[model samples]
Target chain A: MSSFPPFTRLAASLPDHVPFVGPEAIERERGTSFAARIGANESGFGPSPRVIEAMQASAGDMWKYCDPENYDLRSAIADQLGLDVEMVVVGEGVDGLLNLAVRMFAEPGEAVVTSLGAYPTFNFHVTGFGAKLVTVPYRDYREDLVALAEAANANNARIVYLANPDNPMGTWCEADAVEKFLAEINPHTLVILDEAYCELAPASAIPAIAPLRPNIIRMRSFSKAYGLAGIRCGYAFGPAELIRPFERVRTHYGVNRMAQVAALAAFADQAYLSEVVGLVAAGRERITQIAEENGLKALPSATNFVAVDCGADGVFAQKVLDNLIAQGIFVRKPVARGLDKFIRVSVGLDHELDLLAEALPKALATARI
Target chain B: MSSFPPFTRLAASLPDHVPFVGPEAIERERGTSFAARIGANESGFGPSPRVIEAMQASAGDMWKYCDPENYDLRSAIADQLGLDVEMVVVGEGVDGLLNLAVRMFAEPGEAVVTSLGAYPTFNFHVTGFGAKLVTVPYRDYREDLVALAEAANANNARIVYLANPDNPMGTWCEADAVEKFLAEINPHTLVILDEAYCELAPASAIPAIAPLRPNIIRMRSFSKAYGLAGIRCGYAFGPAELIRPFERVRTHYGVNRMAQVAALAAFADQAYLSEVVGLVAAGRERITQIAEENGLKALPSATNFVAVDCGADGVFAQKVLDNLIAQGIFVRKPVARGLDKFIRVSVGLDHELDLLAEALPKALATARI
Candidate 1:
């Protein structure tokens, strides 16, 4: 109602559409659970036994408020990354950090550059902050870094985002190309390299942490390789000067106490992480083989998920995705223009994949008709 | 360093001091944990057993990201508060929600009104957003509503914040005055009535939820009486139209899975909540007795904590606080110019209050110049 409290002008003009819907809601709507839980890029392996133990052990301490400074977790990440603790700031997740970064860099109406089909959450934050988005179409199913850099330079964009071993497309460029892209970034633009999947990707595909660029912030999450998404935790590393501004606006106590504890314990159990990564790799291969057998081409993936081209138009891909959903398989499709011809699937447990194997043939046959 | 981030002019000018220093940091520095953990106003009474059980049971779900919609929690809160689900928005905490509310309503350099020594976190968010803070001094130790509304009208302020059974001072106004203040509010202005301590206060002090004003948003937390502080959850309820804009800027998935489970369980266990409230009221009496015996004036409190007038200035209050800390007691003081004469303390367990009683006289003697 116009009689309602006045929202600031920027907030008044913002759209009401959310970026993505959760599978839980879909299940509630469909009145049935998906047999194959391979959507949303979450780890089927779950958190480490040590992490669960730590969380349970600390359950009684839920009476106390969390450390607002996030001191210990930042120190742990800083030590692991070969950087000072000041170079790090952790939040609810990469999603929360992305929102803060957008607000800090791009005020209202400034252009921000990213791939057309990169993480929709990043675009959501850009739009949430009233920033103008300038998209560079994916080239070869990978983020077109050269074009993105050019767009940033031409538009004098305030921020540029890229996700290596990216979502929906499941492709990555090697570290050398990433380094070169970093070098070519416009002086006025800050680059946010979201490496949420880096731990699961091939080592060579990740840029080395040593030569940390001042204008670049690389965000990581315990949600993927470490498997604690429900805890709502993630971290970003960058120049101290760049990172410090986040304190000005971030929800200081945004990260829950269990999250800080779970993430810390998850990080401590490197053995569990390695084991999960190995299992994910094997699952990805199994998925690729299944795709090949079905006469569809799964993209060469360096991350925990595979994006399979339906070998047709976006309409065909949507039909296939719908068939999969109808067949009780949970999977997601890319919605960005030109990137819409593929469906992305995360690596689930063995039995879950078995369900996928059992259901995909029928879903594909139905789509074909 | 400046080369790393060209922060927006507003961000660059923000002061670096954090809103609150955590007690754990104090414990770590002091090499001993505090006997009385009352400074943060946390419910030393702890959360309900059912809440703890629910959290433990849901610990394994850490791998799956929490439902971004917080569908179940929102519905439960809405049903309890007699509002539509769409009118209730969950956030990390009242602090987190305040940040969003201020941003959605207040513009840079515009005035936002609050009592002089109310919640520092609210002030933190206001200043963080570049709004000029207009303060009304407390009258006879209570938040002066008349002064606050007058200041709001004079400054043409877009937002005003009031905390019932207010923080730092542990005082409140009657429901009639609060209703009058809301009715008299300018249509262009939004009033944030923070009822975080409402559950522990007298029922007559809080207005009925059905009488919704378009410009009013009331915040509630499970932190105080429910004792789920470490879980970091709170909610804001307002008219549907006013509440919808929060979707534009909020960190949707910020509240963790455990928080949702715990909060639901806490809400369901009304018997446990009533028991905790009884204990808190008794503990407040105990704290008052100790203060009165020591010749300090303990203010009448509706909240879980008591604010004791230390019979001296802020520096002397700091001495009393420091001496208590040195003696392994954790307590805090309000730092506003007029309100600095009182030190705030939460009602801890009997043994903890016993420790406070034993230590106070020696600390008082030493605190004197």
Candidate 2:
């Protein structure tokens, strides 16, 4: 390799491979487009019409930079959540916020805890920052709050991550269990409660905003239920003092102007959010039914996606996912050993789901071969 | 102060103040809006009609996550620059790209070089990364390139930053001088040439990209003459080896979907860009005239904004800025010592300039008090 300016020892050590390969890359590789865009856990139901109108109306005003403080959006979010404005901070998305959170809390070589098969972006950040990861294995396909708390305390970790209504497995812990987990974890360990899928999840799976604690930061997003993933907007709410430190390291103008408008409109359109939540619920049911008809066991999901156990092991699930892709359906599976028996599929439009339903049986048969 | 989570020692030591406060903040604080939104060096003329139409048309598709590879946008940028796609990396803006650059090159306590009174966000990143920043003051209102190179060499700096057609001062060094600086700088140092205002600059001010080098990253933005600041899109091109590391740390989906669409359309509509450049040149002339009309000396500008010397010191220039803001004409000034004698005003719509013209005399008179 040609010699160049030296990267930080931490940065130099990180692997080049990203946590997720986007569907677009797969499409380019296959040299054909997938008829069903049912991967990446994005809502195909799309944003509310009001949000679309808001974005369209403001499209011409792209000459101005976004409000660095995100004042208006933060106020609106605080008002909706009944929290102080100082407690809310918005960023490019939950992904951006996670990067900041890790940079803030976890020093290089310090321990950071998360479930083994949780959201990989968090792990990517931890590794990027040179933090030692202490991964607790998932218990019964749900994030085991008890094991995570123990690992965090035992390792003296600086940050502990838990994604409720989690990705890949689409399983969630109840609100009471979450509250107990918050109470039990080491207070010095910042628990990043990634509730990106909160709006799509059952109300019982979400904790109340009242009696907020310093150790936990609750992340919410427009990407899931509001269906504004492409706009790249998410917010994290916690105690005021904790939230203040994000300003130290965040890219001040990272959130674009259109995202602010789209998110504000989406937040205001609760009627549309409710309707999408209903749609996601129905879609999940349909996906589960499809999995059953194809002789696979779909895990009970509190998210917009379902993880269907492929009746074999990691190789079998991978083969099934590959065959689905080959059949013009974009779907994914967990890569970690214990969770690899499952293939995760996101809810899409009805026609897309119909395409999935048509493709599943043939894909399974091919995978068996 | 109450103690919560333990931030990294570097993060904890950094200040909480943001680099720039948005004008909306002033609007909120004063309970009034500025009639002229020309403070932040944003293009009041806005993005092209085609870009707007593209963004508006894609408003409903906010449900899909952005292509993490940024393939199409990077390809577009690379083709325009006569470079391979591997040499290009798209980001949220130059601000976001700057952060990545700092993270990639500067380890804690390592040295970085830049002109004092240049872009504060770059300095913010340097500090955030725990890098030792060695500042070289501008000479004759332009970045002292010789001094910057010397400082980088003396300190064995990991990075050297120079913004051609620079911010705040609206000044630039010629292409030959820049090329000389590039040649003289230590090979181990990564030079970041921020050419954000290159489009509005005289053609001779920007160096040709034909002679590509490993140690330099040329940062460009859609935020300047392209008039898409609000979309928060920018790209950096450099040797592929240098560019590849950015993927290791960048928030893959950090650039939103709307930004990609707007920027692609903006890049394609070069005719609109040419028109905007002409308008910016005309606006710069008009602003210079306005400054002269008010008995202030305006620096000749190659960028969209002019730095008008208030014929006084830093305090007097601040007074002019305050009075303009008080009169609901949003304008800003340099906070650095030598350059702080001038108040920077961005080119705006005709009526906004008229409003600035109306406010300048009274503000100057009140400051004389």
In the order shown, the candidates' DockQ scores are 0.73, 0.85
Candidate 2 chain A: 10-residue stretch with minimal lDDT: A1-10
Q: Which candidate is the best by lDDT?
A: 2
Error of 1 at B121 (Å): 1.3
Model 1 C-alpha lDDT versus the unseen true structure = 0.88
* Candidate 1 C-alpha lDDT tens digits along B133-186: 999999998998888889988998989999997998988888988998888778
lDDT of 2 at B105: 92
Candidate 2: deviation at residue A166, Å? 1.3
Off by over 4 Å in 2: none
User: Candidate 2, residues B27-94: lDDT per residue as tens digits?
Assistant: 99999888999889999999999998999999988899999989999999999899999999999899
- The local distance difference test score of model 2 is 0.91
Q: Largest TM-score belongs to which candidate?
A: 2
